[model samples]
Target: MKRRVAITGVGLIDPLNESINNFFARTIRGESSIRYFASKGDPVPVSIPAVYCADFKGDDLLGKHRTISMDRFSQMGLVAAFDAWTNAGFNVHDRSHKPNAGVSWGTALGGTRIYEQGLREMWINGRERLPPLSVVMGMNNACSSHIAIQLGLGNSSLTYSVACSSASAAIGEAYKRIRNGEANIMVTGGSDTPLIYGVIRAWDGMRVLSPGNEENSPSACRPFDKSRSGLVLGEGAAALVLEDWDHAILRGARILAELAGYGANCDHVNLVKPDSSGQAAAISLALEDAGIPPKDVGYVNAHGTATIEGDPSEIEALRSVFGRQAKELAVSSTKSTHGHLMGASGAVEAVITVLCLKNSIVPPTANLKDIDTSCEGVRHIRIGDSNKSDLKAAISNSFAFGGSNAVLVFKST
Candidate 1:
């Protein structure tokens, strides 16, 4: 028999350092953390419109000794994971082993900051070597390994690096593990820090980074708007604790929502361009997996990155899947306020979706005033709009550059 998966806890490390509650409140209120960010202590600094946690002092939070061996990405991941674990009522001080519990994390550019720093030290400062434990800290799996070790999760420690879909894919797989009865609990989510010089230069070359002056930076990411430019890279982490329904009930845990379905598919059409058919297929698969009719889904946390093509493609896909009901389905992209967290976007958005269901409030796409003609059909939730409908289910989408599409379905418990 297939076991049911429940979301017992959720946490996030956003640019504003807001707790999960504050984040949701501000998000639905259309507040933005995006700003004009400039790199420091580098010969060729990068200045871009982005969302960054300027107050995140790793050493102060994680302790200087514990953080000495970790990269910024791993530090954020561990903090987010630990927050989720504790929120789930798990004892962080308990070092006891749990064979049925595990961790599945995701990151696209894990430890890139460390590598960039090392290269800078070698080339500019004439240093022959990097810091100690650089290799262990720079590995993509380092975050997952650290979470498992710190939490004493022994069932499995896995990581996925599928660009934007990384987190959703990781969450989906963890849900599958619990649903398949292979595990009783799983701590799953994703983290990414893409503000390094190299990463920025690469994206700048692609001409996909949003442009904004100091006055306009906060509204840079206007998804589904006619004046939309491009995506703004953000750095942070988010985590969710997925537990077996029976196990959570036995422990008297507070279940937040049900991770009902996960659908992942590849477009195979283009590397950068999105295909509506493939996206629709994935959404259809997720609804089928959850045994939920399209009409039952009241809201969608769209993967609307405000790109020239991505925004419209996602709307078309939703219309194809939901048909006439798509016209009434409330849809929004929280990326407008949080910016794009890249690999961690899915987890962050998933956490927001869970909160939306819990509070019965659907957040709007911030800074979206004029809707683009090509992105019509759905009930677009604009900034400051109050949506207190009895939302039964919601979908969060994560479509990546490599044609990877991951859709997660959640329902009120």
Candidate 2:
């Protein structure tokens, strides 16, 4: 029999709200975190407005690790993991759970901030690079190892980088390990703070970003809308404490939700685009693994990044997977509120979706004036305001740059 894995605790550090409760409350109330991106002169090309964390104190969580030449991504990961560990009522530094726990984190880019800094130093010193810690601290696995060392897991500490699906894949892989009796507990999630100039320039090069009025704030991202342009850049981290069902109950832990199923696939046909049929297969594979019929799903947390290709492609995938039942399902994109958090997007959204299911409240897709025509069957919650309630379950989708797709099925514990 397959082992059961449950989400004992979850935490989010996003642009809208840092705490989970505050974040969901504000999100459900039709709030938008999208704000004007200050024109900080060159390097930060094209006053590309973005949504950033309102109250992030990475320095406070940095401590000894802060001086280790870590970058912004590592800092976000450490802070988020620490907060999630504490929220789950587990003292990460405590010996009680350290030995049995592990750290498997994910991110699109690790230490982008430090990489930029390192490159600058190299130029200033005429390419005579110094400090062996440059690559070590700037490495992508730095965040995962940081969490592992800080908490002293002394076990498997792996970092998976699959573009946007990095965190979702991390959580799914973590679940697989625990379900297979690898560990009793695992601290898994993702973080990314690569709002650096290089990343944006790279994104712009693809023409995937919305060319609308960056000054208007909301013009950047508008999922499921007729005038939807492109996804807005967002930064933050979200972490979850994944524990065995029996282990959580033994410790009297507050069981939030059961991670019933996880599925992933790659559209091998394309590098940056998805094959229509293959994308749908990924969603179906997830439901099949969950052992739940399509009719069982009440809500869906879409990977709606508001891109011209992303939103409709995902809608089609859902329709193909869920068939006629898709029409009755309530599907909302939390990205409408939080923007695209890149690496951390899927994990944070899963938390939001799980909370919505627990409270029976579905977060609406804000700023969606008109739902697109091609994407039918999926019900969009365009409520004017919101409140807290419980729900049965929530489905989160994460597709990355290279057609890397991940889907997760979650239910209340």
Top candidate, metric lDDT = 1
Q: How much lDDT does candidate 2 score? A: 0.80
Candidate 1 lDDT trough over 10 residues, lowest sum: 89-98
Error of 1 at 391 (Å): 1.1
lDDT of 1: 0.93
Which tens-of-lDDT digit does each residue in 1-413 have in candidate 2? 78899888887776754567888888787687878664344444565657777566666657754756677777777878888888888886697666778988889888776777667668755677657887877889998998888888866898999999999999999988898899889999999875777777888788777654545786457888988888888888889989999999998998878898888999888888766577788778888888888888888888888887778898998888888888877888878777787888887887887787777788888888888896666777786634333556667889888888888889875
Task: List candidate 2 stretches off by more than 4 Å.
Answer: 16-18, 39-44, 64-67, 124-127, 212-215, 385-390
RMSD of candidates 1 onward, in order: 1.0, 2.1
Q: Please write out the lDDT profile of model 1 over residues 181-299, one tens digit for every residue.
A: 99999999999999988899899999999998889899999999999999999999999999999999999999999999999999999999899999999999999999999989999
Each model's backbone clash number: 0, 8
Q: On a 0 to 100 scale, what is the lDDT of residue 281 in model 2?
A: 80
Error at 263, model 2, angstroms? 0.5
Candidate 2 RMSD computed on C-alpha atoms after optimal superposition onto the true structure = 2.1
